[model samples]
Target: MIPWVHIDTGTIPNGGGTLRLMRRGQEFSIQLGQNELMNSRLSGSEVALAELACGRIAARSGARVLIGGLGMGFTLRAALQTLPERALVEVAELVPSVAAWARGPLAEVFGGILDDPRVRLLQTDVAAPIGAARAVYDAILLDVDNGPDGLTHPGNDRLYDHGGLGLARRALRPGGVLAVWSAHPDAAFTRRLRDAGFTVEEVPVRANGRRGGARHRIWLAARPDGAR
Candidate 1:
């Protein structure tokens, strides 16, 4: 058996826990404490998060997408595949080292997707961009801190709160989608989305595509046509 080897460690930014990178033969993993945040082998649900959202706005021209986290580029690659050639995908990664890991030890996993013209990677909190404009993005996707309570950064709760949800609502154009990925289900959040004026749909997807693995949740919330 090939034993797991610790490759590197990085701070999660904003006083979050330490992020450790590990490798066992061909597979790689990024973890915080005992929670495995991401692994090279399990990317199905993450990809689904982008496919479900971008699939909705694929036909639109000049589409813009804001992705809150850049974990191994699975979601970003899926978004790139789903959207049109002219679309723009902005990935806001709270930790700078996460981006560096994407380019360094994890480069093969990304397949050079970061070099795509449609992508703009930023090393900062996602909230700034989400609140920077009104009705700008065609969709806003959040994979931050595993469904909003902050496994890494405590402030991530704001993104799921009424105010943060409102900010996401305000940042999106009418009919835009807000897709969020979570490790587990949270029913209260569904209600919050409803109160925030988004038509919400929660999807259950497997971790390793159709092959079968742990299940994950994805919430697709759509801004109303009449919403500002």
Candidate 2:
């Protein structure tokens, strides 16, 4: 077995917790306490989060996207691949070290996606942009925490709550999509999406793409075009 090595440790902002970077040969992992937040090898669902959301807005010109959480940059890379050159992707990351780790120890995994011209990296809470906007983004991709049932920050719960869902709906342009990734499914959260006036679709995906791994859930909630 290739022994795992501890590379760096980061403190999550607002008392979220500590994030540790561990490496086993070429494979890297970001862990919160004992729980693994993300692994370099398992990026299928993360890729899908961007693919599915960007696919929905493929026809939009100069599409703008807001991606919450820059974990490993899988979603960001995938989004860049799917969107056109004119598209702009704003990545909000509350923990600054995660971004540093991407450029530092995890540079190879990130593949220089952060340096892309379309990417705008923001070291602030995603909610700030979401709250400050009014029908601004074409798509909002959230792979934050462990989905609605977050593990790192207590404030993350607001991002999944009814009020938060309403904020997300308002932040999105008409027919814009809000995609969320989760380690598990929450039926109530599904209900919350519908209650927030979004057309929701719950998708089950593999963690390692087609090869198979853990089954995860992704919620694709679309705001109606006629909605104000």
The TM-scores of all predictions, comma-separated, are 0.98, 0.99
Number of the top TM-score candidate:
2
Candidate 2 TM-score, C-alpha based: 0.99
For candidate 2, the per-residue lDDT at 125 reads 91
Native-to-model Cα distance after best TM-score fit, residue 104 in candidate 1, in Å: 0.7
User: What is the C-alpha local distance difference test score of candidate 1?
Assistant: 0.92
Runs with alpha carbons beyond 4 Å of true place in candidate 1: none
lDDT of each: 0.92, 0.94
Best by lDDT: 2
lDDT of 1 by residue, 25-49 (tens): 9899999899899999999999999
Question: Candidate 2 residues 47-113, lDDT tens each?
Answer: 9999999999977999999999999999999999999999999999999899899899999998889
**How many residue pairs clash (N, CA or C atoms closer than 3 angstroms) in each of the candidate models, in the order given?**
0, 0
Clashing pairs in 2: none
